[model samples]
Target chain A: MSNFSVAFRTTGSVTILALNGELDAHTAPELESAIQHCKNEGAYNIIVSGAQLDYISSAGLGVFMAFIEEFRTLGGDIKIAALQPKVFNVFDLLGFPLIFSIAETEEAAVEMFSKGTTHN
Target chain B: MTATIHTLAIPSATRYLKDVRRFILRHARKAQLPDDAIEALQLAVDEACTNIIEHAYGGSTKHKVDIAIIVDPTRVMVRIRDRGQPFDQQSYIAPNVVALTRQGQAGGLGVHIIRKLMDQVEYLSEGRTNEIRLTKYRTH
Candidate 1:
């Protein structure tokens, strides 16, 4: 089976990507493309909700690491929320917990963005 | 409860690893692992297969890549063999992720992640083939 199914929805300046299924080497690019579109649309903040996400790979992590700087350059940052333990562990292993603003719920993520970016 | 061994030879490309992914997922579901377990299996397998596609081939010109996945009821063993240049896994260790940039391979995360996810992992370097074996146990 292919790794992941991606859905995108935009609200004002925030773009939320809801990832379903697996996020591994093969499907990481699809998410990257979606993020690039967010940048193209001038969306400053990108929130990826992984509440339904099943897994992630190093390639998946690479996509997030590779795009963060570009998003920051565009005056925005990426936040992750509701990541499953198995998936979240991969991000933590890469030390992404320190780099990305992660929240326990999507509401918390939106609240975080509403509160402004202070994790810098 | 039976062992199924399948060997595949295909061109070396990131695209081709999809076949490996599909192969594993089919049996993974048949093995009835929790969704998280299956995903972990996929990650470990990708890390190993990608190492073959990148380090073993080092170039897209590699005509064929060899892969063997063994699925047993108690455990899943993936052995990927390639004829690419030789390297030492033991001599390689990942730099601390906290203080490292994504440049210069960002070393050992692959191997370290494998170790964390899988129950056992080993590399066999001999003759013209480099074999990386990763095994994960199945727990209800």
Candidate 2:
């Protein structure tokens, strides 16, 4: 299997990215590129669905931190949902809950963007 | 379980991190650690290798990082040895995650994750080599 792959689509005004496989240092740049693609297309409100993400490292987490400011400044936010426990623990351990909107389902994440609320 | 040790050396590059993680996971699973513990070990090892590649080697792929996995009945230990720049473990300050997030910083979180996941982390320098040992005890 490929170490990582990203599928992009749009739902309403939100850009939904479905990430599969592992996200580490090597594959992080692919995700960065995907996020940049969204930005170039004028997508600010983004939802990353991690239902297929098997693992993530600090380098992977850094990608989100890198783009969050730009996204939020454009009146949009990056929200994550459907993370496996293994992947979610990494974010939770780093206290990402305080900084990012994380939901249990992709629909909920898109809903949060639509309502313009940070609450997960 | 009988005591066993396995070692691997790879270029200090981010691209090789996947192979490094796979090597550790395969051995960690054979050692029969819990799934969560194996995941934690993989993350911790990846962070350590990344530090060596980025900070120690200055993102140079010419150098090498050596890894050794020591499996015993009660614990699994990972030793990562690098010949890149010497690291000063004593002067290291753990990243303040809250402040980092506030400032929108993307770096400085790798070391913190390593410290949190490993049961014991020891860094030492011997002449030109820098070694980091990470250990996780069996839960059962």
Candidate 3:
């Protein structure tokens, strides 16, 4: 059985990807596919909700790095929210907060998109 | 806690990463490691093994990666060994997140994360065997 899964939902123009289970090299491709599916459907504004995500590795982090620019160029950005403290530490260690818009809650992240903030 | 050495051998594939993490978690708990240190060690070791699975073995699952956890009262250390290509440490430059995003690159961040999470990291290659050791000290 796979240890990680991504669920899709939508709020206004934003696509919310609710990530569950562990994200590592083995399961990262699944996330990549999910984001790519979003792109194919022309849904660029994204919010990755980590409320159910138990763990993440560098491979998982790379998925966001790979697609953030593409979405931004399409006039939408990927916003991350609801990361557990332990999961957040990995992102923080890699200085992700400086590059990605990481909000404390899903609603807060959706708010950022609605406010039209470019790099908040 | 008594000092002990534990070992787990798995195929050099991403699918086995969860088993590696579980081994580390079980051993680290037995060693009474602090929660943060355990978490850091888990991530650091995972990064190291991922590198081995991807760069060392070239995504070939036929190879094996042996992970050893050495635990003592003061700290815990992990030694991962493989017979694949050794990583050229000299050529590794720490990645800049903003620059990576601008260029749309996803990889080359594992090494940096390992260095950040572990107190000491060393890479050794002898003939056909390449090993990366990651150590994290317990905080009182």
Error of 2 at B24 (Å): 1.2
Residue A30 alpha-carbon offset, candidate 2, angstroms: 1.2
lDDT (10s digit) by residue, model 3, range B8-117:
99988899999999999999998888888889889889999999999998999999999999988788889999999989999899998889988899999899999888
> Model 1, B20-94: lDDT tens per residue?
777778777876777767767777887877766667677555557777778887887878777887657758876
DockQ (C-alpha) of model 3? 0.92
Q: lDDT for every model?
A: 0.75, 0.90, 0.93
Off by over 4 Å in 3: none
Tell me the lDDT of model 2 at A40.
Answer: 92
Model 2 chain B weakest lDDT span, ten residues long: B96-105
Candidate 2 backbone collisions, by pair: none
CA lDDT, candidate 2, residue A108: 91
Error of 3 at B117 (Å): 0.9
List residue ranges in candidate 1 displaced over 4 A: A1-6, B1-4, B28-37, B59-62, B71-75, B101-108, B137-140
lDDT of 2 by residue, B78-125 (tens): 999999887777788998776775567787888889999989999988
Superposed by TM-score, candidate 3 places the C-alpha of residue B66 at a distance from the truth, in angstroms, of: 0.4
lDDT of 3: 0.93
User: Regarding DockQ, does 1 or 3 come out ahead?
Assistant: 3
The digit string of per-residue lDDT tens for model 1 on A1-120 reads: 555888888765678999998776567789878887887878879899998897677877777776776677667878998999888878886677887789998888888878786356
